[model samples]
Target: MSENARVTKAAGVVGAATFLSRIFGFVRDVVIAWFFGAGLSSDAFFVAFRIPNLLRRLFAEGSLSIAFIPVFTEYLTHHGKEEAFHLARSAMRLLSIILVITAVLGVLLAPLIILMIAPGFTDSPEKYSLTVLLTRIMFPYIFFICLVALCMGILNVLGHFAAPALAPVCLNIAIIFSAFFISPYMADPVTGLAIGVLIGGALQLTLQLPFLIRKGFYFWEKAVIFHPGVKKIGILMLPAIFGASVYQLNILVGTLLASLLPEGSVSYLYYADRLVQFPLGIFAIATATAVLPSLSRQAAAKDFDALGNTFAHAMKLVFFITVPSMAGLI
Candidate 1:
């Protein structure tokens, strides 16, 4: 097959997987609506959940994927596979250390973060307590999901897209199951949901293990944190984070504004935000994921012409699809 055809095939695969994940995500949301309904408890839990999700997008999925894949892929392209693996191991070690620290800080400071993000919850002690509990339970998700992102970045760098793309489905399935079966047995439904998140993240991480083993990346060992490639990724991550974090910040702003409204307002925003995420999940995200490693490889090879072409074509395809999607959403 021609290079273009090969690229097209990979794009198609990611597109299909993204579509399935989004579909399942919608189903998962529908289940939440049915089980939780729109209430203060649900509203508070959603608000709490939103905090880490915002960070997840800003860091784990958006920034981390964009930054890590390129650097990781560049190593694979220029330095070869072993060098790439070393880079990944180094990056993973750095990521694990940083995320552990962040998660610890998050646990210690969940109250302050909650106070800032959902001040309205302060008025209701019961709801406030519940939200705090849920936030603490769910906040560690950032750590697990970021590690998942590392594994995924490595997978993408290796041209292993399907399992990485499919990981989100496990989270969706976990939520759906929790809502249907676990919630009924639990004293508090939202607690079940929160527990499901930790479970889902674990499961998501688990799904990547076989892939890692298959790729001979399963052994756990440390890599030097100060490696040049790792340092480059750390540097690039900031701007890439800035570029992608705006939408999530927008959601947080919406949530903050919505918090001032009636009881179900936060929940309303949550569900609407999920709807918006569905198209984004498929189009922009899939395109970005499929293109980035390729772009990185091209960049590493100093093939700027190919890099520019790949980016332009990907941007064009995104516009071709996302324009109509935005219009339809409107």
Candidate 2:
């Protein structure tokens, strides 16, 4: 096939798979609404769940993937694949250590964080306690999800996009099953959903292991977070953190405003935003997933012309679709 033909074919596959995943995800949400409905628990869980989910996007997928993958890919392309592998190992260690510490801290501070995020929860001891417990269970999800993102970065660099795109379906499937069969048996639906969240993350991470092993990048050794390449990741991540913080703060402001409106304000926003999210998730992410490694390749060769060309093409593609979609939403 010609280069354009190959690229087009690859994109079609990714887009098709992404569409299926989103369809399943929509079904899962529909099931959740049928089971949970719009109520205090649903509202609280959605808001509470939003916190970690937002962080997962910002830290795992958005910031970390965008920043870390480019650097990691650069190492792989230029310094030799072994050096790139070393960077991965080092990142694994650093991420493990940091996530462990942060998850623990998050668990410990879950009540405080919940209280601060939604002060209304404090008035109901039952809701407050349950939210704290659920948050604690789900906080470790960031670690799994972020590690999955790292694996995805590796896969992306290797010209593999389908597996990473498909990984999320596991989570949605797990939640859907749990919500239907297992949730009623649990203490409550919210508890079941939280458990499903954790299990889904495990499933997501596990799906990547076989692929990584096949690629000879599945060894389990501790990363020296201070390793040279990992340090570069850290350096890039600083700005990434600030950028994510600003974005999250904007969402927080929106949430706060939504909270002031009425009982279902947050829930309405959640559903509405989910629709907005669906296309962006499929298009932007699939494009980014497919293109990052290519751009990294050009960067590795210090071929700014190629990089610029790819960037322009990708931007045009993103804008052409996203602008009209946004206009539709407006």
Candidate 3:
């Protein structure tokens, strides 16, 4: 098969899996809507969920995957598997340590974080406190997700797209189960949703583990905080982080504005955004995830022609797939 044909097939595989996952995600949201409806409790949960969800996808699915693949591909192509595995280990270990610290800080500072994030809730201490409580419960999810993102980066480089793409389906399934079976038992339905997040995060991580192991992923027992490859990834990540933050920044702005409106405005926007995410997650992200490794390999080979061709192919695919969805949403 032609290189372009091979790349297209991989993208198709990723897109198909991602599409399924997004469908389940929509179902999960429907379950949430049925049980929680739109109210102060739902608003609090949305605010709490939104902050971490933004960071989770940005780091795990967006910036981290984009940054890691090129450097990792270079290591694999030039330095051999052992050296590449060292790079992966170093990066994952450092990422793990950082996520743990961040999660801890997020929990400890939940009240202050809530004040800054959703200040409008201050007038209603119950809503404000519930947001804080849920935020803390969900903060540790950052740790599980960072590992999942790193695993996803590794798997994508190895041409293992299906498992990583389908991993998110586990998260949706966990949430759906919680909403239907667990939420009814909780005094606050949102608590059940919060617990589901932790469960889903673990499921996301665990689902990718065996695949990663099969790819001969070498995980370091100790953190290598200062590896050169990790440094390279960090340098690449800084600008990509800003670039990725555009979407999150928009959400932050929207949430700030939404908090000032009627009590349930945040919940309404949250529901709408979930619908928007369906296509964004399925098409745009799948293309990005599929294209990055191919681009990285071509760039590492110093084949500018193939590199340009791959990018062009990706752009065309993304444009054709997303334009209709964008129009429909509008």
Best by lDDT: 3
| Higher-scoring candidate on lDDT, 2 or 3 | 3
Runs in model 3 lying further than 4 Å from the true structure: 220-223
The 10-residue segment with the lowest total lDDT in model 1:
1-10
Residue 77 lDDT (model 3): 95
The regions of model 2 sitting more than 4 angstroms off are: 1-10, 221-225
Better of 2 and 3 by TM-score: 3
**Candidate 1: where are CA atoms >4 Å away?**
none
Q: Per-residue CA lDDT of candidate 3, range 1-330, in tens? A: 766776788889999998899889888888888888888989998999887888886787668878889999999999997788888888888888899999999999999988887888888988998999999999998898888888888988988989988988998999899887888898887888999999999999999988978887846444466789999998888888888899788888899888878899998999888888888888887887888888899999999999999898889999998999899999
Could you give candidate 2's per-residue lDDT for residues 12-128 as a string of tens digits?
567777888899899988988888776666676777777778788788876788787888888877788778887888888788888889888988898788877766666567766
Cα lDDT of model 3 overall?
A: 0.87
Q: How many Å off is the CA of 77 in candidate 1?
A: 2.1
TM accuracy, model 2: 0.93
- Candidate 2 achieves a global lDDT of 0.78
- Candidate 1, residue 124: lDDT: 77
- TM-score-wise, the better of 1 and 3 is 3
For model 2, state the Cα shift of residue 92 in Å. Answer: 0.7
